[model samples]
Target: MQLHHSIGGTGFPILCLHGHPGSGGCMSVFSEHLSQRFRTIAPDLRGYGKSRVSGTFEMSDHLLDLESLLDRLGIDRTLVLGWSLGGILAMELALRSPWRVTGLILVATAARPRGSHPPISWQDNLFTGLAGVVNWVKPGCRWNIDTLGRRSLFRYLLGRQSPEAYRYIAREATPAYLRTSPTATRALRQALRAGYDRLGELETLTCPALVLAGERDRHITAASSRETAGRLPNAEFYCYPDTAHLLPWEISDRIRADIDRWLDAHPEVLRP
Candidate 1:
């Protein structure tokens, strides 16, 4: 795996993991705030953005990569804040390496995958098979700012931002694989099918956790966040009312404030 990352800040290490279909740069909105109080590290997960994957991709591949990243950084223990797909990965990392994870902040994610089936539908499957023809016939139909803007998933995740701001960010943040690679697309579909059901495993998490969700999230329902928090012995759940799936971008300051209070109350978790 070839990983791309950005490291900043000065205190206890806090690793920020971006969601699917985006790169480490997605965290640009919150990096400055987090940097004021932490040694922040944000990385594009494999197969997304500039990260390169050499073999078959699995959810576990991401877990292992994150573990190696921390090891390479010489970070003994760190607080992890993950959004969407990244949130699910953060939970897995904490479960698999309790000692390495000091605490966890899961936003806009669930303990299980959003849908019962894979990431693709029958239409999508057919489209994938005829991708070459479709590309030839309609070169710009697959991915464009307009197409992305119309996606319910995008709306659900982004909530309500200025149209111009949303368009600007989308243009810069959207990944190339979202339009090109069948392999990356297939990996997401397959991984979601496998799901992130770890309710039973939550009992084993020694570190404190904060589960956050947007009240208006159309993708992962707020109920899922509640369910996730209830399963963890040391977890608290918070919902940002009227917000959408992109809680970090939609309401970064509020999220940061909550995190500050949560950390202050649980200082033991921050000690090296």
Candidate 2:
């Protein structure tokens, strides 16, 4: 599928990938922040946003879609920044085609399945169920933004994502979820939950990796992120106190600065 995307700024390219039930639009805030110093491209995966897909698909299909996108854009290789599920995709891409990735920035993600982290608490599960219902009932409904961002829920997801972040979910992620076929989302989620392990493979990733997480992240604990970083040959792990799973959106400024430092250390990848 020819996935739809948004590209801006000018410099070394950084492809930003969003999490499940969301599109490239979810990363709009982060992309805008980095666009001033780096070229940022965010693509809506197949079956989300303006992208099109047929039948069931897995991570392999998503990886191929990205490769095809880079090929069409005449980009041989570029920096990849992925959030949540997108982080998994980033690692997979770098693992499968190390030559095509210059560097990796993984935000609020784990190296394995959700079970690798501490078990989610009942409170977190409540919000998770609420989100699922909202997505199923009116994934594109802008009106449900307030309820989804209710203080209690937001507190669990993150100390609290910014209003802009909430709005992005209302305007972008929600619609993208609605646009995606249920069957497709189910297949992708199932695959992600199938205990996919890549700890042994992380050592093979030649590209430098920066793993960012929140100390308060209920979805993927800081321990999980640290474990993932430890497995990588060249990886650095950073955890923000009081932060949560919405690291990409909640801490864009910090992330951009960190990326700058990471890029400086790995100047080899800056060559577009």
Candidate 3:
């Protein structure tokens, strides 16, 4: 199945994958920054964004879509940037097609995300209401709002930046969040609850990797992200304080700097 994607710039290729319930548009900030030095391909994996939601899909299916995408693009090898669920897909891709992935930048993700299913609370409903109201007042968002954003899941996507940064992120991300497919969201939730973990098959490929996490991330534990770096043959890891799952946006400057430094360390990422 063809996937909807956003492509920009022209340099080293970097495949950007967003988390579940998120669209390629959510990664636009990172893509914009990286596009100067790298070719970024951000895709709305199988069931989100403008991509029509077909029936439920499994991890392998996502992997296949990515592989096919790369093949169609005529890219023999590329750098990878994955966030949350997207990070899992990156790891799987590196393992499945070793030569295809030259490097990985993983954020707020774990090798085997604990299969703990969080129950809905009043907070979720409260945020849902807040999101609904945002849509109510915003003329552009009147008819488009997915009121299923659960607590930090929404804020996590929005990021815990300064008030100005928060508004900036929210203005751009709210619509992306609202466009999330309900069926896709439910499928991902159930998959997590069903304890769908393939940990034994996990291993970060030999390529250099940069694993980052937030000390305050409640969704994907920092320990797990650090452990992922440990298991990697060549990897660097960092965990920021006072940040949550939205490290990509919360400390986006830091992440961008780190990406630059890491690329310098692994010069192979820049060469053909």
Candidate 4:
């Protein structure tokens, strides 16, 4: 598929996968930090960014693309960090090719589709309204993610509402949103809403994982995140209080530090 990717620094490899309506560039902040100690490989998932959109727009297609990318890079195995939609793909990759996955770091993701939930927070409700307006106007645009990244009205929707955090995310996330194709955005969203559950299968995944979510996240509720961590035999779940679904971007530093500690603590999951 000739996926466009960003690779920098040198050490152990860490393939970072981004979320919905976002390209590999969305994870640039996290990758920048990790690049100092690890070879950070971030790719624009098929259909997003500069990657070509060929064949079926399904999760299986992405999985194969990732495998091919690894082979092309001559990487036998490596740690993977997935955010949101990327998190789901990472779990699937671990299940499909356990030997190729050293460890997993899933952020702002859940094991299965969430059914009903409590009343939406005002911040999230406002976001939904704005998102609806953007989706209505552009149909497949990044749901106005560029504006969301820059505007303080939506800053509270993220984990950290500080000006520094907002600026940090705006720099990386805005480009990612701009790079995403409408076709890619629709395809991934459709796949996620298709009602497929892998809860039963998670019990068999033996590789260590770190499942992270935010307390104020409405996309994937905290309960779902906890259940996901509980289902996996070697998974650890952590929730940041008052944080929203944008944990990977909002709490990038903390997430990065936690990931470093996690990998160090689980040497068994490191590639030999």
lDDT of 4: 0.77
Q: Write the per-residue lDDT of candidate 3 for residues 1-272, one digit (tens) a residue.
A: 78899899998899999986588987876899989978999999877778777566665778888888888998899999999999988998988888788888998897777422267578776776675456445523422233333342454433353443344345555556677777677767776778755456555477888999888776887887887888887889998887777777667788889888888889986665
Task: List, residue by residue over 59-142, the lDDT tens digit for candidate 2.
Answer: 788899999999998888899998888898999999899998988899888787453334557765676557546645555344
Off by over 4 Å in 3: 115-119, 135-161, 202-204
Q: Candidate 1 has which clashing residue pairs, if any?
A: 157-246
Q: How many backbone clashes does candidate 2 have?
A: 0
Looking at model 2, residue 212 earns an lDDT score of 91
TM-score of 4: 0.83
| CA error at residue 34 for candidate 2, angstroms | 1.9
lDDT, candidate 1, at 230: 88
Backbone clash pairs for candidate 4 read none
- What pairs collide in candidate 3? none
